[model samples]
Target chain A: MQSLIPLMRSISGAVVLVLALSGNSVAEAPLGLGRAVEQTEIDAWDIDVRPDGKGLPAGQGTVAHGEQVYAQYCLSCHGEAGKGGINDQLVGRIPFDAFPFGSDPGKTKTVGNYWPYATTLFDYIRRAMPYSSPGVLSNEEVYSVTAYLLYLNRIVSQDTIIDADTLPTVRMPARDRFVIDDRTRTESFLRQ
Target chain B: MKNSVSRRIVVQRLVGLGGAAAAVPLIGAETKQSSAADHSMPEATARYLGSYPSELGGRSPHVELKRRPLADYASVTPLQDLSGTITPSDLHFERHHARIPDIDDSQHELLIHGMVERPLKFSVADLKRFPSVTRICFIECSGNLFTSATEHTTPQMLCGLTSQSEWTGVPLRTLFTEAGVKPKASWFLAEGGDAALMTRSIPLEKAMDDAFVAYAQNGEPVRPEQGFPCRLLLPGWEGNTNIKWLRRLELSDQPFMTREETSKYTDPLKNGTARQFSVVMDARSVITAPTYPARLERGWHEIQGLAWSGRGRIVRVDVSTNGGRRWHEATLQGPVLPKAHTRFTFPWKWDGRGAELMSRAVDETGYRQPTRKQLIKARGHGSVPYHLNPILAWIVQRDGQVLYRAEQWL
Candidate 1:
């Protein structure tokens, strides 16, 4: 009986360790099926670009070249020079101080008057654009469209060539107008 | 069908749009008149085949999801066509930004990297090997209601953006633990493999709470429109954020502020300030039975509809026959699941008079569904069309006619 005490204690200790770290392991899968994801695999699929320019790929485009690209691929849905069309109006001059939010339902939310980050426009156009074909835009074409739209919105000059470094730093006019959601704070007002 | 066609032929003969001969195919052509007068036996409809070869047959041809006309890829669930809480796997509402990708489940893989100790790649088979959980919940589009719908609108047309189903899958936290997430991670980006490659940033806390990667919805593999192979099911969150065709998850210290979050879903407020990441859906209910297009006669009418909340379970559902003047508690049919659509019933004696009927849902968190005025007051009059869960009313006139009170919001 005395000799079995150590064996019982060892058994209890092993059970405790297994219980503590069961499914969540570093090198092992409890069921053992999948393998490690390499950096190359991640780069192939992780195409999401952030506002801070962290994920913007290496590319360059001029506003002049962008006009040719926009006319050919983007003009029908986005309209002439991005005027109001079947889809959302993309071009509008931003009087940032006089921006309207609620009183006008018809207010055109342009890149200058609405979007907070210049990188967002590039990221969006690169990913989901032309209304039909997505992920077909070349990196240079994406940058060019980003440049052309920025120029149309009067956010940048006509000759501004947008690349990784220049596009991220372009300050959006309505950047200050966006705030972290305060719906929880205002939820009480819902009752009243 | 044959009887209806023959009856329609008799009726059409009086109208003169066409003769009875024109209505021959309207009913079963096989079940034609036996002699001169009529009276033919009902023909055999269809035989049970071994299996549907390619395209599955719609069991009930009447029940159908009404696709938005000439917009994007968007369709609303048939709420009036459905009864009870669980929405059929096929009838689930679809609001895809781009085309639904035809994902090969065997070739599909989810890559979890960025700010994790061990970047793990998981296959569908690997995920199934882990512990699984089943919960009945709803995935609702943030923009559920269109304020300008006409009087002919049915419950499906009104707010059919929401659908409930019993989702079975592995909790995301288990995967997060497997990946060994870093302590500094605050937000995680969920990316899909559709044509648009849709992506949304979710708070890590919310993902760890009850969020799961759902493989099967309502006992079968998740439908193509509702994300196939696997999709992230954030119970009660907006349908856009519950990304379909989920491909990758990247943990980060800050939100990615993607196009969907930045320029689109963000609500424009009264003060010229756009509200970002306004996530959880508030409590709301609609009386579907006595609503628009559904005629009601003066008598004891049992008002029935669905009430749901993203916050938690619905505690009480209050109903009003005479608009906001008088209110009564509705009998919430149990067992009411959390973050799910709960059915409610209220018996009311209609007096054959012009009146307005509305329903108010109060969730477990003491939040009552707001009135139109309250919603407008809270979110300016021209608030962007997202998360608009205002208490709705149906106008009933003395002539036994019902129409949606859609114009009042304007």
Candidate 2:
């Protein structure tokens, strides 16, 4: 933390000062060339959903309603309850005993078996799914599909409703299976 | 001799006609039609003449990537067909989660929103107007080497996911200046405009460091396949985080944990836990030629390959002729730039006996690439299926047939 003290000045002003300190030629900067983005633009594009459901828009969905939405949109590519598709598999997790987390690596990586966060499902589907037409789903449609997929994986019941509140609270079975990267380039992982 | 006589006649006739229109033959003239048989034929004579007028270029007929079977979306670069360090822009390897989309630069906009004093949008033109920077480095997929691939395979098949190019762009910090990033902002989510809407959360410090908003690759506007119009250039990082076809960057205090970073790119350890955000691709090296399909006649031969490290520059690359039994330092080609591919070569004499050929690279950081046994032992037998860079072994038979010493690791 103390090391960053020299870089703590205002971003624009600090850049030149740091350059000058390093003996590089420091030039005064003008305001950037981009235009100020409108709130409407941000609202339209800021669709990423965090694990805590911070980015999920206001909406609710039940597995019952999700079934219809799934059938109408997601059923073809994800195919017959998200199993066996041309693109990727979203259902049918391998048994824990088979791989035991990372004991034996396999080719198959279904959403239920590998994904650590359920909000990731909602976030991905909302932004890019139904392949041919992404980002066209309403908040309701997005919620329904997320619910249907969760129910298909047996993480949620058919009667269970999902919203911003209930969505992030849903713990994924593999949530505890992830670790932070610890590689510093000199680890024995590469020092054979 | 005939062509010279015809050329002299034509030139003399042309010169006689004020060095002009005499060379132009009438459309239906028999003499002009007969000139196709002359060696000095200047007009189209054969069926469908040749490819006309172009400013840029194409590869020699021999250059092509080895496409992954069944997976129509990805292909590996033909490293054996190339010499020196830089990969020709056309032959660069490609791995797309979704097929390449035909993006319209006119309609495209890069929006930097979220925690900021003034959330701003930059057009392709606006980005080009900023203080631009050009750099030569490599962009490599963390998931480059495959375990199942074996000998008789091309270099592209062994490891073709990484490619080096001269990238031109606006410094990401310059853009951050315009937006006035909030002090609390720690991470920024970079999203692509592809069909998958590929996303990853990058640390703000990395953005302020060496990141760029690249718009050109290899002296030309970026290739459509390589995020044309624009892409994020996260120097020395895994290829995934340098999101291609960049469309948005949202700053926040925490990582967005997008699907690519979580379920896809994470590295799972043997302890039932996976490593999240393992974005740094470690040191790796591989021999390009004198391998399978490339038969060798016993004599003087040059042992050569490519070496690179995402951590820094490659300081040493050791060549082993008799497997890992005997090792010698390879001649390091000059301009061993940091985070860029460095070419290494060694002169050798084949004794006409079976031997194993291998190369190990040690980077400036003192990090050495592991052997197959070491790599698997350290990462576990069934480890995460990415960033696998092990010492590759090629068995050279006495009969001069080169074969891959295929061993099970993953």
Candidate 3:
């Protein structure tokens, strides 16, 4: 049994070395099951936008054009000037320093007070908006409505022209209020 | 014993002499009268043959278990009606951002692109060709907090957004490896094909760990409500991260910060800071049997429930019958796999006195589940929105009625 223990230890050490060398790659030989995909094919489905404005499309929208777009497609659900209706209130800023939504159930979390990134507004509206009809808006219309909502939130002025380069530069009110998850496994209770 | 035997013999002699006539009054007037109208006798039932075989089978006609619909978007599993560990595929909880999409498996395709040596697209058939793996784990919603507790609330109504199943799938790491994932790729975006096009950013480390693209659940094809052709299954992570009806995987150096991850699912703390990507569900347990609405009789009973931890296996579950003043170690049912629901039981007797019943779970990580008061004290009333795993207590009245001890922090 003593001799067997050394042999087992050596085998386990070799296994660890193999794992370390492989890194994220699987150790097994590739099955080569899937077919290669082209970039254009990926582009059609790649609609996600990052905080640093990685995937924003080339389109410019003014707050004036955005008002018309919001009135036409977003007014019914989001209400007049995004003050809120049956859906979520897209415009509200109860002193960014307050951060009372966590405790107050009556407080509404709008795009202005809760969302951390201006790019998220574009990503969310472009992917999911109008509740009844999603992905129906043109990229130009999505940018316009995003700008319109931002204007209502008072983050951007009515004259601000929101395009690919300018949208990422727009700082959100709740940007600095967010933190990464710090909950650890060792803690028997949640960290305060 | 001899006196009872003599009594039984006298009764048998009387029954033998006058069959139905002598048994009528002794058996009770209600049963004697109802026997003539109802054909539910054991002898009569045994004489008849059962149902014939069919192409599709269903639950017994007498049994009616169903998922409770919260709204148009989600439905909760019937936890109290279940036994053992595996939640029946049909009864598994459903939480879809949009309506359930009906996609033909032949037309479904999974595209893996961005930050890879070779971007690949795999069909459902192609994925099936690869070596498959099976695991039994749970998917719990981060917002599965049941704060509206009442006397009528059952275990199903309290916390039923979690359910376990034997999931079979291709390990996501194999697919990532086949695609030759670049060393720079730290996170990946999982996109769904539903109308909402639900997307979530997942760490690549998790994808290489236990995450998989599940194609089957409980020995059958994944249901339409549960990401039909294939779905990403991140064991122990928040249910929303396991993107259903998976259509795309875009590897990136950083998180995409999608709407689901940002505007929703994030945990908000009392100190003005919200926690993003708080994915892992903490340890939680609930006493399913003898819970709310169960009237007890003065006799011996078994306290049965389930305990699970996302971090690891449930090492211990303590049952307290006296409002946590005393806790007895529960007997964990065998096959306690990691990241899975484990059944636990404790023998208990009712002394016809009012008592409070509670169960607390301790995971392999040595993290013990906290009571409602402890949870409130630590996180404050503001953190009541998500990831709530506080100990649930039930009050037994002197008259044998059970009710939930609902806590109010807000």
Candidate 4:
């Protein structure tokens, strides 16, 4: 059945072909084009971490260690304690009730005020960070940096140990503020 | 006095004989020497043989079309200087998070895995062997809107981040079919091979519909800036979602919620909610010619510009010579494919008085391009930094100078 799925998907009149094949009791056949990938190969490339922390590697990091990682890596571009310098600001928080980002140009969208998911920090820092160098951070380093940023944003305390289990549990302040796109191709320009 | 009278008589006779006789140098011997310097003697080109053709072709030295670099990471297309719909592959607008990575196509491979009936790894060669599809569509960044408008702003400087191309590649549906997607799989994560390893999550329905793995642009191998070996082409979606340098696809039940989708590309609204996954660019049009620094004369001129919509084809583009009081239907150039840039034109006779010119595009979906006021009213001030598709206005002054209206809201 799995082998026949490809042939059925490729052809427009697949229903008729499937009926004919079922009558003849013939075996299912695939196009036999690409080779099957191994789990190890998949694991090496699959670096995406989901909101539920599904793809997170088995590692733990503390805020104290995260501070060291921040000082070595993030201080120059992100400023002392993530106050901001040249690149994007990583710290600072707006009141959860106040969503002034839309009306005020002066409001800065920092990690604490804008990001909806804590898992995103781990995913982004792991895949692309340090601006000049990316994909160089170890899983521990990524977790530590993620902890440090979260700590600075006041989402987590210094005593907390961040791991795959605990990272997803940390609720971001802007989590509920995001809504799916609600645009439609109607004559009226008004957004609901 | 006698010599002057004789020359005048010769000039009169030459005038009587029309322009052909004037080139005969019948006045004096010095007339022959000065004739070499005459502006209308076919110049000096006919006197010498032209250069032979070379291995590669290039634009004429007289043509000075070029892409303007917006910053170190991005460069904008020269929209005002271009004609027709298809943007030249080299001059296409470029916006990369990191630098363009040099890739060897032979070594590149695409891996499709996770929740699939059969996880597969296919080389570039393998993907090309499958049936190929070609399409013409425009890829526009969500942040394509250039708000830093001034009187000196050109169309390129205003909104040049969008570009159209004829892409040729295998449809993603075919590859997914070969891999045999699981029934539970609803979304897939597209990851790039660049240093940034840029990633975006797309719904499976969109992948099955019009998405293709494009390897060629404008009948040539994709440019390095445009993801050289291969890239994903999601017709009508925002540019970033059509992940370039595509290397992997992981099927899943839910979206991975990548940084590009969550933190950066999302739009904030006045209602205290940020809109996520706002992919489609609404209908928009802009007058390119007789705009900004182009000194115009009071005679007949064709008002030309480009209009496009992500939802569908542009059905009508109305041009207004006066400030939105009266509008005339502009002629649309044929072969207007869906989600492609459509060229529109309207003839106008300028009376040397100050006038504002604007164009409004209506797509097949009946979505008319909104005015700046309408956009601001709906989205609120400073709320929408992305997906801004307001109709742009160009002011033509009494002194025959054209400038961008540069509204205060911008």
Off by over 4 Å in 1: A1-33, B1-70
Model 3, stretches more than 4 Å misplaced? A1-27, A185-192, B1-46
lDDT-based ranking, best first? 3, 4, 1, 2
lDDT of 4 at B128: 76
Q: Relative to the unseen true structure, what is the C-alpha lDDT of residue A162 in candidate 3, on a scale of 0 to 100?
A: 92
| Model 2 C-alpha lDDT per residue in residues B1-410, reported as the tens digit of each score | 77558767656755675555654563235365466666584855567677877996675577554434326667777777678998878777787878788999988899998888889888999898777899888888887876687766767777878888999999988898888899999999999989888899999998998899999999988898889789999878898888889999999999998988887888776766777888877888989867777767678899888999888899999999998999999998989998889999988888898888999999988889887776666566657568888899889998788887776765
Model 1, position A139, has a per-residue lDDT of 91
Chain A TM-score of candidate 1 vs. true chain A: 0.80
Off by over 4 Å in 2: A1-27, A93-99, A189-192, B1-70
Instruction: Show the lowest summed lDDT stretch of 10 residues, model 4 chain B.
Output: B37-46
Mark the 10 consecutive residues where model 3 chain B has the least summed lDDT. B37-46
Model 4, range B151-193, lDDT digits (tens) per residue?
7899998899999999999888888988999999999999999
Cα misplacement distance, residue A161 of candidate 1 (Å)? 2.4
Ranking by DockQ: 2, 1, 3, 4
Comparing 1 and 3 on lDDT, the stronger one = 3
Give the TM-score (vs. native) of candidate 3.
0.88
Candidates' C-alpha lDDT: 0.83, 0.82, 0.88, 0.87
DockQ for all models? 0.41, 0.44, 0.41, 0.38
Best by DockQ: 2
- TM-score of every prediction relative to native: 0.85, 0.84, 0.88, 0.88
User: What interface RMSD does every candidate have?
Assistant: 2.5, 2.4, 2.7, 3.2
True contacts kept of 1: 0.71
Query: Would you list the clashing residue pairs of candidate 2?
Result: A179-B274
